[model samples]
Target: MSTLTKSNHIGRKISRIRELKDMKQEALAQALGLSQQSISNIENSETIDDERLIDIAKVLGVSVEALKNFSEDSVINYFNNFYDESAKGQILNNSCSNLTFNPLDKLIEAYEENKKLYERLVQAEKDKVEFLEKILKDK
Candidate 1:
Protein backbone atom coordinates (compact mmCIF):
# COMPACT_ATOMS: atom_id res chain seq x y z
CA MET A 1 0.00 0.00 0.00
CA SER A 2 1.03 3.61 -0.51
CA THR A 3 2.17 5.43 2.63
CA LEU A 4 -0.93 7.63 2.56
CA THR A 5 -3.19 4.65 2.11
CA LYS A 6 -1.47 2.83 5.01
CA SER A 7 -1.82 5.89 7.19
CA ASN A 8 -5.50 6.23 6.38
CA HIS A 9 -6.04 2.55 7.01
CA ILE A 10 -4.35 2.80 10.39
CA GLY A 11 -6.41 5.84 11.26
CA ARG A 12 -9.66 4.07 10.40
CA LYS A 13 -8.63 1.01 12.39
CA ILE A 14 -7.75 3.15 15.39
CA SER A 15 -11.04 4.95 15.09
CA ARG A 16 -12.92 1.65 14.95
CA ILE A 17 -11.04 0.19 17.94
CA ARG A 18 -11.60 3.37 19.93
CA GLU A 19 -15.32 3.18 19.19
CA LEU A 20 -15.42 -0.50 20.16
CA LYS A 21 -13.79 0.41 23.44
CA ASP A 22 -16.40 3.17 23.88
CA MET A 23 -13.75 5.88 24.14
CA LYS A 24 -13.77 9.37 22.74
CA GLN A 25 -10.72 10.90 21.11
CA GLU A 26 -10.31 13.14 24.14
CA ALA A 27 -10.43 10.17 26.46
CA LEU A 28 -7.88 8.27 24.36
CA ALA A 29 -5.69 11.36 24.31
CA GLN A 30 -5.88 11.59 28.10
CA ALA A 31 -4.98 7.93 28.44
CA LEU A 32 -2.00 8.42 26.14
CA GLY A 33 -1.06 11.74 27.83
CA LEU A 34 -1.45 13.49 24.49
CA SER A 35 -3.47 16.54 23.48
CA GLN A 36 -6.87 16.15 21.84
CA GLN A 37 -5.52 17.91 18.78
CA SER A 38 -2.79 15.30 18.46
CA ILE A 39 -5.39 12.57 18.56
CA SER A 40 -7.39 14.45 15.99
CA ASN A 41 -4.37 14.77 13.76
CA ILE A 42 -3.72 11.06 14.09
CA GLU A 43 -7.30 10.22 13.21
CA ASN A 44 -6.88 12.45 10.18
CA SER A 45 -3.79 10.49 9.03
CA GLU A 46 -1.35 13.25 9.80
CA THR A 47 2.21 12.23 10.57
CA ILE A 48 2.68 10.85 14.06
CA ASP A 49 5.84 10.13 16.01
CA ASP A 50 7.03 6.60 16.69
CA GLU A 51 6.77 7.05 20.45
CA ARG A 52 3.25 8.34 20.10
CA LEU A 53 2.38 5.36 17.90
CA ILE A 54 3.70 3.04 20.57
CA ASP A 55 1.72 4.86 23.22
CA ILE A 56 -1.43 4.58 21.12
CA ALA A 57 -0.87 0.90 20.61
CA LYS A 58 -0.33 0.42 24.33
CA VAL A 59 -3.47 2.34 25.14
CA LEU A 60 -5.47 0.31 22.64
CA GLY A 61 -3.95 -2.95 23.95
CA VAL A 62 -2.60 -3.89 20.53
CA SER A 63 0.79 -4.12 18.93
CA VAL A 64 2.24 -1.36 16.78
CA GLU A 65 2.38 -3.83 13.87
CA ALA A 66 -1.27 -4.61 14.32
CA LEU A 67 -2.13 -0.92 14.38
CA LYS A 68 -0.11 -0.26 11.24
CA ASN A 69 -1.13 -3.25 9.15
CA PHE A 70 -4.62 -4.19 10.26
CA SER A 71 -7.26 -4.96 7.65
CA GLU A 72 -10.79 -6.26 8.18
CA ASP A 73 -9.84 -9.65 6.84
CA SER A 74 -6.82 -9.85 9.15
CA VAL A 75 -9.02 -9.10 12.11
CA ILE A 76 -11.53 -11.74 11.14
CA ASN A 77 -8.73 -14.17 10.39
CA TYR A 78 -7.17 -13.46 13.77
CA PHE A 79 -10.38 -14.36 15.54
CA ASN A 80 -10.79 -17.42 13.39
CA ASN A 81 -7.20 -18.54 13.84
CA PHE A 82 -6.68 -17.72 17.50
CA TYR A 83 -10.03 -17.89 19.23
CA ASP A 84 -11.03 -21.34 20.42
CA GLU A 85 -14.56 -22.42 21.18
CA SER A 86 -13.83 -22.60 24.91
CA ALA A 87 -12.43 -19.08 24.82
CA LYS A 88 -15.49 -17.92 22.92
CA GLY A 89 -17.70 -19.46 25.57
CA GLN A 90 -15.70 -17.69 28.30
CA ILE A 91 -16.01 -14.42 26.46
CA LEU A 92 -19.75 -14.83 26.24
CA ASN A 93 -19.97 -15.79 29.88
CA ASN A 94 -18.09 -12.66 30.91
CA SER A 95 -19.85 -10.40 28.41
CA CYS A 96 -21.69 -7.19 29.36
CA SER A 97 -25.10 -8.85 28.99
CA ASN A 98 -24.21 -11.10 31.93
CA LEU A 99 -23.57 -8.13 34.20
CA THR A 100 -26.13 -7.34 36.90
CA PHE A 101 -25.72 -3.57 36.56
CA ASN A 102 -24.50 -1.33 33.79
CA PRO A 103 -20.89 -0.28 34.32
CA LEU A 104 -21.87 3.39 33.97
CA ASP A 105 -24.57 3.02 36.60
CA LYS A 106 -22.00 1.52 38.98
CA LEU A 107 -19.64 4.37 38.28
CA ILE A 108 -22.36 6.96 39.00
CA GLU A 109 -23.32 5.19 42.21
CA ALA A 110 -19.70 5.19 43.36
CA TYR A 111 -19.30 8.85 42.42
CA GLU A 112 -22.37 9.85 44.46
CA GLU A 113 -21.15 7.83 47.43
CA ASN A 114 -17.76 9.54 47.18
CA LYS A 115 -19.40 12.96 46.98
CA LYS A 116 -21.45 12.30 50.13
CA LEU A 117 -18.36 11.07 51.97
CA TYR A 118 -16.43 14.17 50.99
CA GLU A 119 -19.25 16.42 52.16
CA ARG A 120 -19.35 14.63 55.51
CA LEU A 121 -15.61 15.05 55.81
CA VAL A 122 -15.86 18.75 55.12
CA GLN A 123 -18.63 19.17 57.70
CA ALA A 124 -16.61 17.23 60.26
CA GLU A 125 -13.64 19.51 59.62
CA LYS A 126 -15.81 22.60 60.17
CA ASP A 127 -17.24 21.13 63.40
CA LYS A 128 -13.72 20.32 64.61
CA VAL A 129 -12.64 23.90 63.94
CA GLU A 130 -15.63 25.21 65.90
CA PHE A 131 -14.88 22.86 68.82
CA LEU A 132 -11.26 23.96 68.85
CA GLU A 133 -12.31 27.62 68.89
CA LYS A 134 -14.69 26.97 71.83
CA ILE A 135 -11.94 25.14 73.76
CA LEU A 136 -9.51 28.05 73.20
CA LYS A 137 -12.11 30.58 74.40
CA ASP A 138 -12.62 28.55 77.63
CA LYS A 139 -8.86 28.27 78.28
Candidate 2:
Protein backbone atom coordinates (compact mmCIF):
# COMPACT_ATOMS: atom_id res chain seq x y z
CA MET A 1 0.00 0.00 0.00
CA SER A 2 1.03 3.62 -0.51
CA THR A 3 0.87 4.26 3.23
CA LEU A 4 3.28 1.44 3.90
CA THR A 5 5.69 2.69 1.27
CA LYS A 6 5.70 6.19 2.74
CA SER A 7 6.72 4.97 6.21
CA ASN A 8 9.16 2.25 5.11
CA HIS A 9 12.35 4.20 4.38
CA ILE A 10 13.78 4.19 7.90
CA GLY A 11 17.41 4.82 7.05
CA ARG A 12 16.65 7.67 4.72
CA LYS A 13 14.38 9.20 7.31
CA ILE A 14 17.09 9.02 9.98
CA SER A 15 19.67 10.56 7.69
CA ARG A 16 17.34 13.36 6.73
CA ILE A 17 16.42 14.05 10.34
CA ARG A 18 20.06 14.20 11.36
CA GLU A 19 20.88 16.59 8.57
CA LEU A 20 17.90 18.77 9.35
CA LYS A 21 19.05 19.03 12.95
CA ASP A 22 22.43 20.30 11.69
CA MET A 23 24.19 17.31 13.20
CA LYS A 24 27.17 15.49 11.75
CA GLN A 25 27.75 11.75 11.77
CA GLU A 26 30.55 12.25 14.24
CA ALA A 27 28.23 14.18 16.54
CA LEU A 28 25.56 11.53 16.46
CA ALA A 29 28.19 8.88 16.98
CA GLN A 30 29.46 10.70 20.01
CA ALA A 31 26.00 10.91 21.45
CA LEU A 32 25.38 7.23 20.88
CA GLY A 33 28.86 6.05 21.90
CA LEU A 34 29.55 4.90 18.36
CA SER A 35 32.22 5.58 15.80
CA GLN A 36 31.47 7.77 12.81
CA GLN A 37 31.66 4.73 10.56
CA SER A 38 29.07 2.96 12.66
CA ILE A 39 26.76 5.93 12.38
CA SER A 40 27.29 5.96 8.64
CA ASN A 41 26.47 2.28 8.36
CA ILE A 42 23.36 2.77 10.45
CA GLU A 43 22.15 5.50 8.18
CA ASN A 44 22.81 3.32 5.15
CA SER A 45 21.08 0.28 6.59
CA GLU A 46 17.61 -0.52 5.25
CA THR A 47 16.44 -1.90 8.56
CA ILE A 48 17.39 -1.02 12.11
CA ASP A 49 16.40 -2.63 15.41
CA ASP A 50 13.58 -0.97 17.34
CA GLU A 51 15.67 -0.28 20.47
CA ARG A 52 18.52 1.19 18.45
CA LEU A 53 16.09 3.35 16.53
CA ILE A 54 14.68 4.65 19.81
CA ASP A 55 18.15 5.58 21.05
CA ILE A 56 18.97 7.30 17.79
CA ALA A 57 15.70 9.19 17.86
CA LYS A 58 16.47 10.42 21.36
CA VAL A 59 19.86 11.68 20.23
CA LEU A 60 18.16 13.40 17.32
CA GLY A 61 15.56 15.03 19.65
CA VAL A 62 12.66 13.34 17.88
CA SER A 63 10.37 10.42 18.51
CA VAL A 64 10.36 7.14 16.62
CA GLU A 65 6.89 7.94 15.33
CA ALA A 66 8.15 11.26 13.95
CA LEU A 67 10.94 9.53 12.05
CA LYS A 68 8.52 6.88 10.77
CA ASN A 69 5.84 9.37 9.73
CA PHE A 70 8.07 12.14 8.42
CA SER A 71 7.13 13.64 5.07
CA GLU A 72 8.11 17.11 3.95
CA ASP A 73 4.68 17.76 2.50
CA SER A 74 2.99 16.90 5.79
CA VAL A 75 5.32 19.20 7.72
CA ILE A 76 4.69 22.03 5.30
CA ASN A 77 0.94 21.53 5.49
CA TYR A 78 1.04 21.57 9.32
CA PHE A 79 3.03 24.78 9.48
CA ASN A 80 0.87 26.45 6.87
CA ASN A 81 -2.29 25.81 8.85
CA PHE A 82 -0.63 26.60 12.15
CA TYR A 83 0.65 29.98 11.04
CA ASP A 84 -2.57 30.84 9.24
CA GLU A 85 -4.62 30.27 12.36
CA SER A 86 -1.99 32.06 14.42
CA ALA A 87 -2.22 35.07 12.15
CA LYS A 88 -6.00 35.03 12.36
CA GLY A 89 -5.86 35.00 16.16
CA GLN A 90 -3.48 37.94 16.23
CA ILE A 91 -5.63 39.87 13.80
CA LEU A 92 -8.78 39.22 15.79
CA ASN A 93 -7.14 40.06 19.12
CA ASN A 94 -5.09 43.08 18.07
CA SER A 95 -6.45 45.13 20.96
CA CYS A 96 -6.11 42.45 23.65
CA SER A 97 -3.77 43.96 26.22
CA ASN A 98 -3.96 40.94 28.52
CA LEU A 99 -1.69 38.72 26.47
CA THR A 100 1.63 38.57 28.31
CA PHE A 101 3.94 36.67 26.00
CA ASN A 102 4.55 37.03 22.31
CA PRO A 103 4.58 33.77 20.38
CA LEU A 104 5.46 35.21 16.96
CA ASP A 105 9.20 35.02 17.64
CA LYS A 106 9.00 31.33 18.47
CA LEU A 107 6.77 30.71 15.46
CA ILE A 108 9.27 32.48 13.20
CA GLU A 109 12.08 30.36 14.59
CA ALA A 110 10.11 27.18 13.91
CA TYR A 111 9.35 28.40 10.38
CA GLU A 112 13.04 28.95 9.66
CA GLU A 113 13.87 25.50 11.01
CA ASN A 114 11.19 24.00 8.77
CA LYS A 115 12.58 25.85 5.75
CA LYS A 116 16.03 24.38 6.33
CA LEU A 117 14.53 20.92 6.72
CA TYR A 118 12.58 21.34 3.50
CA GLU A 119 15.74 22.19 1.58
CA ARG A 120 17.57 19.20 3.03
CA LEU A 121 14.63 16.93 2.27
CA VAL A 122 14.64 18.05 -1.36
CA GLN A 123 18.40 17.45 -1.67
CA ALA A 124 18.08 14.01 -0.06
CA GLU A 125 15.37 13.04 -2.52
CA LYS A 126 17.56 14.14 -5.39
CA ASP A 127 20.47 12.13 -4.02
CA LYS A 128 18.29 9.04 -3.65
CA VAL A 129 17.07 9.33 -7.22
CA GLU A 130 20.61 9.74 -8.52
CA PHE A 131 21.80 6.76 -6.51
CA LEU A 132 19.02 4.58 -7.87
CA GLU A 133 19.73 5.74 -11.40
CA LYS A 134 23.40 4.89 -10.95
CA ILE A 135 22.53 1.38 -9.81
CA LEU A 136 20.20 0.93 -12.75
CA LYS A 137 22.83 2.14 -15.20
CA ASP A 138 25.46 -0.12 -13.70
CA LYS A 139 23.19 -3.11 -14.10
Query: Best candidate, TM-score-wise?
Result: 2
Model 1 C-alpha lDDT per residue in residues 45-67, reported as the tens digit of each score: 74457887888988886788878
Q: Which stretches of candidate 2 lie over 4 Å from their true place?
A: 1-7, 82-139
Report the C-alpha lDDT of model 2 over 2-84, residue by residue, as the tens digit: 76565566888899889978999998987787999999899888789999999999888788999887777786897798789
The residue pairs found clashing in candidate 1 are none
Tell me the TM-score of each prediction against the true structure: 0.49, 0.55
What do the candidate models score in CA lDDT, each in turn? 0.77, 0.84
118: Cα error in model 1, Å: 15
Each candidate's clash count = 0, 0
TM-score of 1: 0.49
